[model samples]
Target chain A: MLEFDNTERTNLGELGEFGLISYLTKAVEINEPSTLKGIGDDAAVLDFSNKKTLISTDLLLEGIHFDLRYVPLKHLGYKAVQVNLSDIYAMNGTASQITFSIGLSSKFPLEAVEEIYQGALIACKKYNVDLIGGDTSASVQGLVISVTSIGFADEDQIAYRSGAQEGDLLCVSGDLGAAYVGLQLLEREKNIFLENPNIQPDLEGKDYIVERQLKPEARRDIVELLAKIGIKPNAMIDVSDGLASEIIHICEASDKGCKLYEDKIPLDSMTYETAREFGIDPTVCALNGGEDYELLFTIPQADYDKIKGSMDITVIGHITQASEGCQMISKSGKVYPITAQGWNAFKD
Target chain B: MLEFDNTERTNLGELGEFGLISYLTKAVEINEPSTLKGIGDDAAVLDFSNKKTLISTDLLLEGIHFDLRYVPLKHLGYKAVQVNLSDIYAMNGTASQITFSIGLSSKFPLEAVEEIYQGALIACKKYNVDLIGGDTSASVQGLVISVTSIGFADEDQIAYRSGAQEGDLLCVSGDLGAAYVGLQLLEREKNIFLENPNIQPDLEGKDYIVERQLKPEARRDIVELLAKIGIKPNAMIDVSDGLASEIIHICEASDKGCKLYEDKIPLDSMTYETAREFGIDPTVCALNGGEDYELLFTIPQADYDKIKGSMDITVIGHITQASEGCQMISKSGKVYPITAQGWNAFKD
Candidate 1:
């Protein structure tokens, strides 16, 4: 588990938009050879040769997807771009360009919009893509941001959840459940503030989890890292939903089953600590909490040695025969079938 | 002035989602040589052996961009896609794919989302592109749809708003004003509906104007028509915000002035008649009314013959030296400088 102190609580307003964007996307490494430009123009340029273009879009509304009283606009902007980019990345293609459509209430000053743009533009520059165009309008409620991303890859290079092999080795990127736990902390702090506006909420020693809630970066690098090691995931998906939910997608699509090791799960130290404080099982948070933005994938075991010692790589499970059913092995040697506890926007 | 009667109303629920989309995008003609497929796949394909990729996006919220009290969802969906595609078309590039991100309210059902997609898919087929991917979420208010379009053109073939040459002939494709008049008619009918909910709308003779309002098509054909005639516009933009507004964009981008002939402005006969009935000047509607989705461009006069006698071509203006100032010449030989009365979502 990774651990960090939450002593630094910078006011997002001080960074401005451009500064925030530059600060956050400063480490994104572009790996796709087809990416003509990653993040700095009216649009990202791509050279797909003769393949068909692929584009996808998504919209995240404030108060609906998040609560602004707890979430920062800069992180919100970053997550918005990450969520859309995940779709493209899931298709095993690199996003070349993106368009941002933003809706702000009259109550929000222009500075708020600028801060959002800062996060967006920073993601663009880090991904090496351009901010081509989008629409802006007024909303009666909270802020709404929609981003559409474009990506390209050869037909053969694309991987879908439908193509996993029964014998494939299932793998996942980085840690899980941090973002959800981060949200928990933010919500807790907000409650404290609501109880008394003058209270400086106790966010001490919770920086990692809080950052996870505020600005979770997409695993664009994992895709590249795997490619660099000459490994192509048979079936891959970004973990926008919980790990169990996404695993079910792979199973349903590939018509296969899986067994995961509970003790082998990756959990950042702060996330585990907070989950314990909240009286929730850390494993449950790891399994049910969403928005990790990690990449879950399967690969042939023949190449397992190549990825084993790598940073943040966890071998939590293995794919089983279809009839085996999806199950997880508990640390106490208990076997439990996974159930869908997905976050459904429709279930008000 | 073109002339027509005003008594037509159509309920969108009649066609549902699939039916409405099929009805509107039935006539889109693909002209770009690099287009691999149009509007039927997870993503549109583009043969990019000789060109660079460009993409853009936009989001339109009901009540903000259009009043559902007047505008139907079918048309709203169609226009949503058209507007994004128009951005690519404005750059003298051919759109190859689109991604739609929709935020639907609980008031809407699954059928409504399909209806919106139907409109989007119809445009995809018409424009010879693909519906790549998109995200859907619940909204707290009315519907909001965001669309991102991907396009391509040779590096040199790409046209920007800044490329208008002095003395170039300013040209417009298709007729205008009908959409604006149609909007006015719909507003009146909406008022009547609010006054008496049981009285069925009196709609019979306003098919042309209503179609203009309910199912406005983008001028994709013009892109092909000009290509077939071997003419690339020196500068181009889709007339979304009315002629006066679009012309101003050209003037500002090109750092040049423009002259327009009021006598040459094209207006549908139905639109002109409706304007008179409403006691509004037909030309004013043409200049200030938006959502025409037509191409307003400038080409060197050397290619004037290429555009002359072309179907739906209008020689409404010419590019002038910067010192000449931007103004329009009326039939009585009076000059009135153009002002951007087009919509500004930010203004109070």
Candidate 2:
């Protein structure tokens, strides 16, 4: 629970939907020239001129997606926006607006909702995305956040999942599996705190991993950087469901296969050390652990040299023909087929 | 509950998120030339060159917005799309595409989810809108549907709530209070069935009311009719959260007042009879009993003559100066002030 500046806790019921929305969005200012109308209307109006529009939506459920026991409301809010914005970036588009619809039970006070909105506002400010229209309803139980992000790009520049060529080079921006490792740490600490209420969490030097889980950043810079260098990816996907799963998605969609190297999979030193401590393989963590929010894209063999030595990018593998199947090449050169059976939100 | 078509059932868990989405959207055809990309991509790409883009979203919680005991899942799906499209129509825009995000519990079978998807597909087909992209995830409890509708219109054709002027004629498309009356009938029948499972629902004579409640249609035809007649509304809103609430919204936004006539309020004869049978005032139901998905607009008095004789429209009232306040004048010459509060989802 977050410490409230004011001890007077006002229930959400005190302010109905209209009052609550007005109160929270009172200070919201629309600066985008494209945005003709923002909140306070039946629908927001935007003029994208000749540019193509990009749209994506994500729904996050409480208990199913995040546990509020350790995850702060503000970070959850920020992470929610970041997660949705990542989808637009994956399409090589510029995110310009987002609508956040959150349903909460009676357990959340007005202050809590404000905290969540504040964090989301911070994210909108940082990304230069306008907070447009949204709906807030009463939840029967727990919190539910549904974010819809709107973006724009040229028709020729938009990346599709089925555009990868058979021999295209597969590259991923930023390291993988950090957020998944962070989740394990948070869950472990949450269990400890529940067992012994007096013991403080031992998160002394785990800021990097913890932040990765709590407030992951989308790789908008990677998209902009590639564009600046006149390189357009043939196929692209955001690593929201682990590197292996995303690569499989790209392969299946493009009617191709891929060879991801285990040694080439990017894993931070901290992630490796923590995985070893937990008696887990860092490679498996990178493979199965999701929510990395990095761009995993494929480019032509000729264009690979342009991005070869980028500090933030790692050349994980190359695409293969469909008959070859998606496989992972181990350090000892053993092959393993990739599967699409990951990130099951339904799996109890 | 809806009767299952077959004795055999496939659980939603069996297919997982990816398989379920793939199975459901396999037959989704994209006919819109503007739709560059559809369901399989991270984000849908749309080309709306030289047009203003419109966006609207709605979040509906299962228990609050619907009851599965009587409401068919397929109808729920269709109604969800209709409700969202109503907002876009209210803005005088043509809804082109929508993104549906539904979170459901394990209780729902794959067949049940398919039913809902089919209903939404039916609506999409009828409206000539494409189901571009969506997110399907597991819920901890009942169903949660969040739909974001995308639309486009010329700048001059777009309407806003804050454009009404004094002496503008207030009008409504279609009759009101039918949906609320339908709700009462369904609830009574639901209770009767719950008390004795052997007793079937008695919906023989209430076909119109039941359909109004279960499958409300947006006033897209009215919008087309108005466009054909070359009469542009000064201000407009969709009647979702009752007539009174919507009128209040228009009045507040436009900085104007209204004089709604009791006798002029369009209530179908069936709605009137049903409201009396339930010991509720038909006028009150029309005023405050929500979910009617009709268009409520204010047109300049000069344009009133052109729309006065339209069968689907009613000249309910006229806009007044702000100081006059929003009031409903009775047939017996009484006046009542309007307020902006209605539809408390959490209220028992």
Candidate 3:
């Protein structure tokens, strides 16, 4: 759990909405050439010229999407931005700008909001994205964050989820299930701490999993690497709702089926061991666990040689005709239809 | 007040996130040629060719930014889009697309959400804007709505708040203060109904004022009319935060001062009569009541004749040197410094 200083409790009402907006955005610097106007305007102006503009948005609410008791304000802000940017990257576009809006109750101090903006600015700088515009409001209850990310790409270079064809190789980047296992560890420690405040969290040698949950990164490197290697995926999407759910999305959008090989799925040793300790199958976690911001795409067979021998990219499945249906081939030589057990916000 | 059918409660959880997304977006149609790709993709794609892109966003929360007790779901959705589009129009741009995100608790039925979307689609159709992309999630408490609007304009035709000259004419579109007075009428009726359930709302002959509060319209016509008259505003902003606050923003951003004549301020007959009944000054309602969504702009004095006969546009004041400061000249020829009493979301 993160520690916050309660001594500095400055009420948000003192600044008012306009004063608070000015104070919070004073540190914002515009670096994107497309951004002609940033904050302190009725609207932000951009010049995308001939490139196709990509837009996506997400809304995250407290208690539903996160728990303030365990999640730090800075990490929450960083992760919120990363998740939105992941959508743009999934379209094979270069994210260049974002608009962030937040609604928080008066219970939060000025310093707490500052921390959130600090973390957001850090991520924006690292990714070379401009913080162009946003809206701020007071909520009646807990915190709320809404982000809209904007990106650009040449029309011919953009990849859509419906562009996949039969006989395409399904590829995934890095490993999965780490973020979900990390959450399980955090929840366990939270329960223990609630039962007895004196017992510290036993998170020794668990840094990798914990970090995965706290600060998941978007796969910008994968997009950049593909451009350098001259390989354009036929279809692409980010693994936000677990590998199984995202793969299903690709198949349905493209009107095709897929055969996912269970043995070929990449899993980090720590994620596997942690899931085992929690009495959960690692493969189930990999297939159903969400929040792993990895990239998943399909490449044509002719371009397979271009991505072969890459350590980060692994071929986990192959697309098939619609008649075959989407299936998962287990290591035991048994085939089962793939169903999405992805996280649903409405579920209790 | 609005009535909802409680007998048609369809649990939102029955349809998972993906299923819900598909069901909600099935009606979305792409009408803009610029929109290469719309819903069903990771991100919406648009090509604006050579025009500068304009973007703005707004966050609306229940019980704070709005009180759902008297707001109809349909009206709320319509007003949300208008308010965000007002920002783009304030920049003298033509709004083309929007991305809307919402969060609601499980207590809401699927039909309730459909009503909101119905209102949003109506607004989109009327404004000639496309609903490109969005995200929906279950909230832990009351409803939340966030909208991001996108538009386009030539670089030279765009108006920035910092471009006002010292001697520009201060002009405003349409009358103000009705929306504020309308809210008072609704609150009075709501209190009476809470104390005595059978008491009917006495809103007879008050349709004009009430509609102003529930369904405000953005001044897109003013932007187009200006282009037709061959007059470009030196600086412009929308009156979302009342007349006084918006003018103050213009003066501050341009590093100049303004003299607003109280006698020239536009006030509707219904708004004036209603404020008198409520035992409040009508001028205060116009100066600081907010939510007008009218356009406030400044143009060179040489173009005054071009707009003199237009009934909708009212010339209220003129820009002054920085040493003059922002002041209001009352009808009695008394001068007073203008202070911003605009609506603050953080205020209780």
List the TM values for chain B, per candidate: 0.85, 0.98, 0.98
Q: Which segments of candidate 1 are over 4 A away from where they belong?
A: A1-47, A50-54, A152-157, B1-47, B154-157
Candidate 2 vs candidate 3: the DockQ winner is: 3
C-alpha lDDT score of every prediction, in listed order: 0.75, 0.90, 0.91
Cα lDDT for residue A147, candidate 1: 82
Query: Rank order by TM-score, top first?
Result: 3, 2, 1
Order of models, best lDDT first: 3, 2, 1
- The residue-by-residue lDDT of candidate 2 on B209-277, one tens digit each, is 889999999889988999999988999999999999999999999999999999999999999999999
State candidate 2's DockQ.
0.76
How good is the docking of model 1, by CAPRI class? acceptable
Best by TM-score: 3
Top lDDT prediction, candidate number: 3
State the DockQ, from 0 to 1, for candidate 1: 0.33
- The sequence of per-residue lDDT tens digits that candidate 3 reaches over residues B1-348 is 568988898888987677677788888778977788888888999999989999999998998877877889899889999999999999999999999888998778888988888778888888989999899999987999999999999999999998889999999999999999999999999999889989988999999999999999999999999999998999999998889999999999999999999999999999999999999999899999999999999999999999999999999999999889999999999999999987777766
Worst 10 residues of 2 chain B by lDDT: B339-348
Compose the digit string of candidate 3's lDDT tens values, residues A241-284.
Answer: 89999999999999999999999999999999999999999999
Candidate closer to the true structure by TM-score (higher is better), 1 or 2: 2
TM-score of 2: 0.98
Residue range A1-348, candidate 1, lDDT tens digits: 111224444544444333344454454445556665444322345666765455766788876787877666777778788777776677677777666777766555655666677887777777775555555667665678988777776777676777788778888888999988988888887888888988877889888888877787877788788878888888887787789988888887788999988998899888888899999899888788988888888988897998988987788898888899899999999999987677666545
Tell me the interface RMSD of every candidate, in Å: 5.7, 1.2, 0.9
* Ordering by DockQ: 3, 2, 1
